[model samples]
Target: MNTRWMARSALAFVCCMAANAWADRPATQTERQAMGFDDPAQLVMVRDLPFPADSDTRAPDGAGLGDEWQTRIGTAFQGRTGAFNFGGQAPSIACTSGTERFATATFDLPAGAAIKYVDMFAYDNSSSEEMLVFLLSVCQGTGGADPPVSTILANSTTSGTPGDTVVTLNLSSAPVIVDRYTCRYMVRVNMASPGGTCVGGSIFLDKVRMQYTP
Candidate 1:
């Protein structure tokens, strides 16, 4: 098999491991019960936002990466098979310079959904000098397109290990619930400091991985 396919297989296996956690658990009342049967089956809800190359806008460079989330365009990457059908440039975002820059994306998660894990796939071409930060947040989507962030649910940093390949990074945190309709899920990426020699556009945010249930 090709190297890309192998990488994808590994990623799929890793993702399944997360779903396995919710397996064997009692089915939710709204689930199989509504179907008129009591068969045991776990439900996995995943919402992916493929950071389209043209979707990011420059955030205020003066903030410390807090409630300064700006607006971005696009819906969840779900149902977009064309997104993965890559022949040329794949979708992604990168650090402009060594100074920290932020690219934000919106995630449309179902109501009453409990998030299990927030994961991100990162590509590090140079070294540790090009580490990136991935975070999950919730904010009130008021004031038009821009939303004011309220809480930072989870955050994680890339190891920059295996320097030339893509690795998975999990934002280690417990499950958090969001009930407010005005508030929405946010995925913000803080590009690495001194962004490194990966200047060939090597060091960048690849794709986001999410494991949760609705």
Candidate 2:
């Protein structure tokens, strides 16, 4: 074999081995950046309000909303009476109001984090009403003065029945995401009638989490 040829062949083999090694190893920093995975920030804990402390007149049980963080709505309803209770077992928090119901809560995300997703876990505790309708809204900036970007996260006027149920809403949907920017957002829980005998029931929201994929 010619020495020059042998040297060239050896170089090619070395290059092949290097390529294979790179392929076998997990994605590296440079490779991830090339694939748009650059420095993605992990979602940190934001505000989590369960709602209805003794001070909160909205909770039904008067036990208040419990330890879970939640946004509460005060005398916003015209004829509605009774605090929207967060505490108590099944059947307690079921929506019982005859008219459109609205409840408000505040949530604070860290200053610069981009909220990628919001997950809500709720249970239909009503025995009479088989279904419920609800909406979740988020507001930017502060107070009622701020125009809220509202989305009907869950509209279960037909399906879903009473009992422990899990519903997932993708924030990427048109109504949920609102915009690409990240700022402080509020979540509003609204219940509406879908006609028929309008059964009064309660709904217990277990958990609401915001996922920030920065």
Candidate 3:
């Protein structure tokens, strides 16, 4: 074999191996820039709120307006979707008066981190079932403006037939800024319907997940 040909072949082999190694490994910032690729920022799952089976407010027990809704099993104002059962906004307090029917869950968010969005897994079994998710501050407001900020993360009005047609409500566009030292935010799920229409079929909240960016 010619020495020049052998040297050229060896150089090509070494280059091929180096290219394969680079492709196998995660892309570095410089490599991505060279390829004209901007690695997309991945959403980080910061919190997951699932319905507790042994929840006290599952059925007979009632979750009155402005009540702590940690347990979510047999609570008042609930409906079943064959696949899963969830709490609904029955005995709605929002229409009744200043009070509102909501289930509150607190989650720890790191200080200075901003909320990207929230995912609410639920199904609307009835027409015009209004589901509202809000992110509230945990402490008093520095300027005394409502003490805490109540930002609406997600809101959906169901308009489909009653069935197991579950869907995910994405509150991606609404990003709430987290700047509290406590690093805690309260999530409230307010499920209800039009005035004077508290029926059995309401929006059922099955699960909730949130993402944030530091």
Identify the leading candidate in terms of lDDT.
1
The positional error of residue 196 in candidate 2, measured at the CA in angstroms, is: 9.8
Against the true structure, what is each candidate's TM-score? 0.47, 0.39, 0.42
lDDT (Cα, tens digit) per residue for candidate 3, span 110-179: 5665454444555556565555544444444455644332223333334454644333333323334566
TM-score of 2: 0.39
Q: How accurate is candidate 2 locally (lDDT)?
A: 0.38
lDDT over C-alpha atoms for residue 80 of model 2 = 27
* 149-178: candidate 1 lDDT, tens digit per residue: 334444445555644443333222334454
- For candidate 2, lDDT tens digit of each residue in 1-214? 5999999999998996554331112334533322222234411121222222344232242122221223222222121234433333432243353433443445554444433334455556554443332333333544456444332333323235566664533322222223325343554444323331223435554444444432
Where model 3 places Cα greater than 4 Å from the true spot, the runs are 1-100, 138-154, 159-174, 182-184
Better of 1 and 3 by TM-score: 1
Indicate the worst ten consecutive residues by lDDT in candidate 3. 42-51
Ordering by TM-score: 1, 3, 2
lDDT of 1 at 25: 32
Instruction: Give the C-alpha lDDT of model 3.
Output: 0.42
Rank by lDDT (best first): 1, 3, 2
The candidate maximizing TM-score is 1
Residue 179 shift from truth in candidate 1, angstroms: 2.6
